[model samples]
Target: MLSTAFALFCFLLAADCLETHVHGDLFVPDAILRISAQNISIGGIQRYTTLVNGSVPGPELRVSEGKVVWIRVYNDMTDRNTTMHWHGLAQAASPFSDGTPLASQWPIPPQHFFDYELQIPNDTAGTYFYHSHVGFQSVSASGSLIVEDRSNPPYKYDDERTITLQELFNLTDVDVEQRITADPLLWFGENNGFLVNGKTISDYGVIDNSTATLAVIEVDPGKTYRLRFIAATALSYTSFAFESHDGLEVIEADGHYTKPLSTDLMQMGSGQRFSVLLKTKSCDELEQSGRLDYYLQVETRERSAVATNYALLRYRDTCNLPESSVHHLPTDSYPSKKPIDLPPTISGFLDYQLQPLVPNNFPTTSQVTRRIVLNVQQFEDGYYVWRDSNVSWSDASIDSRRYTTPATPYLVSLYTNQTAYLPKYDAAIANGGVDPTTQTFPAKLGEVLEIVLQNIGSISKTNVTPGLLETHPWHAHGGHYYDLGGGPGAWSSEAMEARLQGTLPVLRDTTMLFRYNEATQPDVKSGWRAWRLRVQNPGVWMIHCHWLQHMIQGMQTVWVFGDAGDILKVPRREVEGFLTFGGDVYGNGTHVPERVHFSEGG
Candidate 1:
């Protein structure tokens, strides 16, 4: 039912190649991270996990646009060895501070610490945060990593609210892991209902008679407010709308600026961040009678059983409210016009499918390159007495042994002066041997090209229906980029070239939804696993799954770019290895590590 090689990687992420102590600005723990759990009731019952420093939601670490910051994380949690990755941070370009264990740096030995430094870019702004980037950032392991406006924020809100939308549960790691691992019915696409900041539906055990399922944001009706919303769900795209409000202007997404798109409903996926200027009315006008009475709401509409808020928008200028206004003067720099109407139809539009959005095609100069198939899977493993559902989070003990049901990020690390490899169809490619798909491209200087994505999963067919291709949103660090086009999985080199000549797709520095199933099928959504981008930007760029846990579990890699003059020569290890093996004598990857012993396939 499974290949031995894959199974080996799963159980043990490969023995270390080098035994070395790492030092730098990375987040290496100074001591063991202490995380405690308590089972509580809201609608029913749930367990809330909190990190050390004693906050259910961890402390917020603020950095500026241009600075070199060092993070030293000491893993204090018991049971398993761990590491932290800076999800969405530009890693490929930023190498040392990438934060990915094993791939970019060494895994922090249990009871030990590791460190590295991140050269935060000068232009970084908007709202972006960081978490364990190790696993399940959707759970309790993450917190906001905000790069504030070096100059005071232009808005004048009474208070600043950084709300992270995530799910929580009462079960232990063992409890949840045992069920999902044992039962195939509880497969890849599952949602555990719990909110770290928001309340639960069915009154789950956390809430009783007094509290509501909303995180309140108070404001005066006259002044505009800035609400930076971050959604960190494993598989949920959320929307926010207001009934008794003027309008909301979207200024940023995924921590980067975008062509200002105004809308009441702010939509985003995991790893995506959005900010809106909530233009509120004045406080005095409300003192007489109609106070700023409002509601705040979130729904798991992506899946069937959705949740609504008891206090959707309950805000007023009461004595209990915090200072909502900032001392900085508010500026009316970007005037708000009538909101853009959502498109009603695309009936006759000529569709060439989609292609990658890098300027020009590929590149004439690529110093280092690599192609990876983000293989995702759903197995038909349990056919006997095992059948479990009504899935909830696991109990504490299960946390350590837990692995994922779906396919996680298969790493493809590249170094300067190395020839990247791409695999072809039918035949799966490993480190070297022969790449069914291989290419050589050029890397230019001073340009920071954002990468576009496509699906890269195994093709699984049902007897009667089409196969499934898992789609994940492609996330970048340092900055966000415009999204052009993404091809259907069927595209090869030839057709992709033709589609590039058409009109450009929309530019989005924010997080844009990537679709695996057709739009009409709401229950099924995913993004391309196979995508490409130009490494014009300098520094390390981290590319990984938006599902933070997947990234921590090894669904991550790094890219490095240096000045054109400093660029190293291509390492022809693949050419050398392939030639050495002779044809027909198979090998795994071109850059074969010197450790493995192999010969021609007898």
Candidate 2:
């Protein structure tokens, strides 16, 4: 009887193990995200907004590093198309999953679905995010992507939190786009309020005694917490800080580990993320002194209109009561203020030195194979046009309307031997022409390329502030680049050589292009930013200004690496899948429509 019982137990154990492997481990991080439009209450007013999985900020997606993730996105919205870009993920082997509309694949139209299979590299374990890549849809359809490191971490922290920073607008996304096209100078409409993690403190002026709940962070005494802050705003650059809390350690920026630097205030531009470690005070002492509540403040930067938003941080064990029962601190405790005063040495966000914790194995500056100089300038041929290297990037619909012929997708052109869409550098430079509308620079695989971005200030209109240059945050897809030092003025070959003689550069995916100033002691001139990276990933990659307005206005370009022969190595099946479904799928899955163009008129 004992032998028979033992044999039966073994059989059952085998069945359980088989089921676990087949169902649990194989599909560990699978998710089905439903995209639709819904009326949600912000502060007190109800407004129609785009949403993913029925939430403003969507859902927090956590996946372990070195694992595969499958996300099936279902578009249920009746009016608009949707595509989700895994921002900051290299998408090295799976370029189709990059999710750039037209460039990677067609937009998922209403009542359609798309499955994205992504493999997270073992080395890329950091804070990232996902958002809509089509039009202004990302204003609401966005979420945080946290990649957990399997190995031990370099820093110590007892707990962690993720906070998404955004700005709330009264006008819908469609209305905002229409306004942008009508007013050339208007990039974004006025934002009504700011939000922290899709929640904010009720503003008495905007709404009358609203009962909106503020985002709360509960922490134990004597414990350290790591906070991952993501700037998901469509238009604002935000400065964040915790009142009465000091010794914040910034350890990571833009999904790359950086040298630990301590700072009082942290600044983040759109599409940027930073991780900071905060040490909490003891609960016993705080409760005794009646100082258990603290405020997390976020303020807008680099804009004429400014607003501040606040959240709550309370000690979990201070009162031994539920979080909802805890009384909120007085609204007047944290007053809205201008930029906080910091020492001259650490005043701007660019002042902090971000050195990569892990050394990259790439060629040095002296070993660079290709060098390109691109200048950003605003010109007026018939209308205001922003151009980089003589060409203002545009899509098929825009080119067809302007030139009477639809342009092909840059990525498709690169891999399929369609060279018309590629930029003719020699002709463009010689004639100072920006014809053809679509532009791309070509590079060979494994070549170390250096791109110097020279910024020339545009002439401001009489009604606008004169002599004020707009600050641009530039971002690149596919891989992170090494940020060589940059300075004021057009970056000449001599200037680059002198700058590289100084300290070794760091790795960064998103960087700021500061405005030029001539009267300063240093006599800053037109801004210049430079970066170098090897073309290890053989695919078409996009490099563009992160400002949503700038990107839509042709302030973007692509770097096509390798020839058609090299692209053939990428699985034919995968390439065929994109070719079959790419371009505008709004009607009949064709490239264009007679009356409605997907890429024209904002």
Best model per lDDT: 2
- Steric clash count of candidate 1: 114
Candidate 2, residue 422: how far the Cα is off, in Å: 5.6
Candidate 2 — which pairs collide? none
- Tell me the TM-score of model 2: 0.81
lDDT for each candidate structure: 0.41, 0.66
* 1-602 per-residue lDDT for model 1 (tens digits): 23466447445854322211223224233222333333444433444443534454556677777665655555554444345555545644334345544333333433443333455666566676655543442366566777877876544455566767766544443344344444332333344453535444433443343332344455645556667877766655554456556457666555554444456555556776767777765554444434445444444444434443323344455433334431211111111321223222122111222222233243321422444333332223241011011011111122323322211111222332234422231232242212223211123444434343433332223231233333344465433443444444443445444554654432333333244343322112244322344445544344444643333333333333443233322222322221221111111223112211111101
User: Candidate 2, residues 220-308: lDDT per residue as tens digits?
Assistant: 88889999998888776677778678888888887777778887888777788889999988655565556666778777766666667
Q: Candidates' TM-scores?
A: 0.61, 0.81
| TM match of model 1 to true structure | 0.61
